[model samples]
Target: MDLIAKNLSYKPTDQFHLNDVSFNFKNGNLYTILGRTLSGKTTLLKTIAGLLTPDSGEIDFDGKDFLRTPVWERNVAMVYQQFINYPHLNVFENVAFPLKQRKMETNVINEKVIDALKSVGLSGYENRKIQELSGGQQQRVSLARSLVKNAKILLLDEPLVNLDYKLREQLREEFKNLFSKGLADETILIYSTTDPRETMELNGEVIVLDEGKVLQVGPAKEIFENPNSLKVAEISNDPPMNIINAEILESEVSFEGISINAPKHFNNINNKSFKIGLRSSDIILNEKGYEFEVELAEISGSETLLHLKKGNTKLIMSIEEVMNFKIHDKVKINFKIEKAYAFNSNGDLASSPFRSKNG
Candidate 1:
């Protein structure tokens, strides 16, 4: 099923929950709403699921008005962070509940119920009570419930939030592989979360939300590599992109009071003022690099986050290997000039006026 949201906004009392937002998703693709907490990610999902009606705007599904349709008749299945389960019901009953409510045949219900359980790797535990399962297992049971309904449109609101790291990763792979094997391009998967693992690795189209506004939306790779706004870059990455205030000159760019060859993107620009963004992975520290004072170094597994302070900019550098840089370490940091991006004071990307193939 195709989904389209046009200029959706929600305001309750004095709070502006959602701003004017618009986007469309075709069948057979996974789309993720990515933003920081309180960024209206969940609100957008709820609005789409018909749980919260938009104060203004329209929702269309395959050219039909879905906002006006009854929730049950919308054929949209949702698995939310706060799972819905009948505390009084057993696992079997809970999984079969939706089908039973629809009054499907006994044979059909049994077949679909078992199939759903197997799909979620929750086979053979159907006889147990809902409270007997662990948090992850219970979440799987909830997923099975969504699958059993055979709804073409699926909405997942941080469904893995309650699960531990290992279970979450494993389950993510399971879902991805299942859908890939099926290759159903007609089934739309809309997941709302702040996890880069969910949006970036899954190749989902990311819709960046801030407060109630849809700041940006695009393919995962494009958006991550070149975020239009500083807020977008900060909210979209694990280590966040490094931003340095660099003064543009006739021959090159200046950072930390050091100058480098004119970058390919700026090979022709005569502008004297601009800001440059360098991803953590793009920063290289060497004796011959640009000198910036390191204020802090954070070690995370194999990567080290170097928070450097130079002049007025605090640039974040993502180093691949763990380094023993102390606080206030004076070091030279270099970047892949061609791969770097330049943004103006207004947070908009500005390509080098000088045309270069490297950019």
Candidate 2:
């Protein structure tokens, strides 16, 4: 099934609203909705599930109008942040609830429920009571219940948010594998998350949202490397994208007490002032670039995060190996100019030198 939302807008209250959001998605692909709190991720998901109607615009599924379709008639299933299961029902009974409601044959329901349980790695736990299982296991049961329904669209609203760190990591890998293994090959999977890393790990398409607005949508890596706007560059990154204010001259751009050759496309931008986006991974520690003092050093596993500053601008760099650098230590750092993203004074993407090369 193909899903399309055109100019979707919703205003439930003054605090939260979805403004002119639009996107096109098809079955057999996983999509991640990324944003901070109150960014309308949930609202958008609910709207797609037919739980909330839009004040304007229309939703089309496979060229059919879904705006007026009832929630139950949409063939959609949503797994929320909370694991909701009947305490009195066993795992099998819980997963078989929907099939039973449709009056499916007893033998067929048993086969489907068991198959779904095994798909989520909960095999042989069919008779386990909901209250007797661990939190992660219970959540698996919930996922199995959703999978058993075999809905055309599956909406996961931070379903792993409540799991422990280790369990969340394990489940993330499981979910990714399950989706790729054709368990729901013909299903449109929409997963919501606040963590940018989660979107990267999923390695799929992403839609960046902020304050009820759709900022950008594309392949995860593409959006990360070539954000369409300053807001997109900010929300699409973890530790956030490092932004520096700069001024464009005729042939050079000046910022942080250094001048670099300007891209030819800069001549088209009407504004002289601009913001440069540099990902932490794109900043290199070398002896040939600008000098900056290390403000802090954070070591995590096999990687180190260096917080460097020059004059008034702060930059963060992630290095694979541990560096013996202390606070206030002066170090030379350079940028991979080809990887830089420039945004105009109006916050829209102005120039990307490497976009063509990557395209």
Candidate 3:
């Protein structure tokens, strides 16, 4: 099945709205909606699931209009951030509820329920009451319920948000393996997450949304490495991309009492002012670049994060190797021009010097 949303817009109030959002998704691939809180992630998923109507636009599945289709008729299963299983029922009954609703044979429902539970690593918890299960176990039961429905589209809205960090990590890998193994072949999975690392770990196509607007959509790595706008660059990074105000001079860009050679694509834009985006990993500690004082340094696992400042601009650099640098120490660093992203004064990406590598 293929899903398409054209010019979808929804406005419940002035503060929250979706504006002219659009996308094309095919079956057999996982698509992630990456955004922060109140960024309209849930609204978009609801619209696709036929739970909410778009103020203006159309939704089509395999070229068939589903704008007016009833939620039940859409053959979609949605799992929410909360564990939504029936509290009064046992795991087996909860997992078998959807099958029973469809009036399947008793033997078939039993077989399917057991199989689904096994797939989610809850093989022997069938008779356990929902109230007796841990948070993670309850979530597994919810996932089992969704799987038993055999829906063509699966919508997951931060399904792992309620689990502990370790459990969330485990389930994340399980979900990815399930999809990759073709267990859900021809099924369209739309997952929404606020964590950038989660989006990256899924290794799927990503749609970045903010303030109800679609910022950018592409492969996870592509979108992160070549964000099309300033908002995208900001939304795609966990620590946030380092943005510096710069003026495009005659062959160089000047900022914060320093000047650097302008990228080839920006040579024609001389005299224009723009914002440069540098990833924390792209900022190298070297002896041949601009000097800055380290305001703070933190060691996290095998990596070191140094907060450096020069004049009024603050930047974060992630160093994979161990460094003895401490706060108040002056260090020299260089920006990897090829990895830099430049946005115009209007916040749109103006130049990407290394985009061809992805092409």
TM-score of 3: 0.87
User: Which candidate tops TM-score?
Assistant: 1
Q: How much lDDT does candidate 3 score?
A: 0.86
The local distance difference test score of model 2 is: 0.86
List candidate 3 stretches off by more than 4 Å. 62-64, 248-253, 260-271, 287-289, 293-303, 321-332, 356-359
1-359 in candidate 1: lDDT tens per residue? 56888898888867667889888988888888887788787888778777899989999997789899888888888898976888798887899999999999999999998988888888889888888888878888888898888787888888887788777887788777766666346678888888875778677788888888987889998777767777787778777666777877876878767777766567645565766766677777878776789899888768888888878878788878888999988988777776666667777766523222222
Candidate 1 residue 129 C-alpha distance from true site, Å? 3.9
For residues 104-125, write the lDDT of model 2, one tens digit per residue. 9999999999899999999989
RMSD value for candidate 2:
3.2
* Residue pairs whose backbone atoms clash in candidate 2: none
Q: Which whole-number lDDT from 0 to 100 does residue 60 have in model 1?
A: 94
Clashes of each: 6, 0, 0
**Candidate 1 error regions (>4 Å):** 13-15, 323-326, 329-332, 352-359
Which regions of candidate 2 are displaced past 4 Å? 62-64, 248-253, 260-271, 287-289, 294-296, 322-331, 356-359
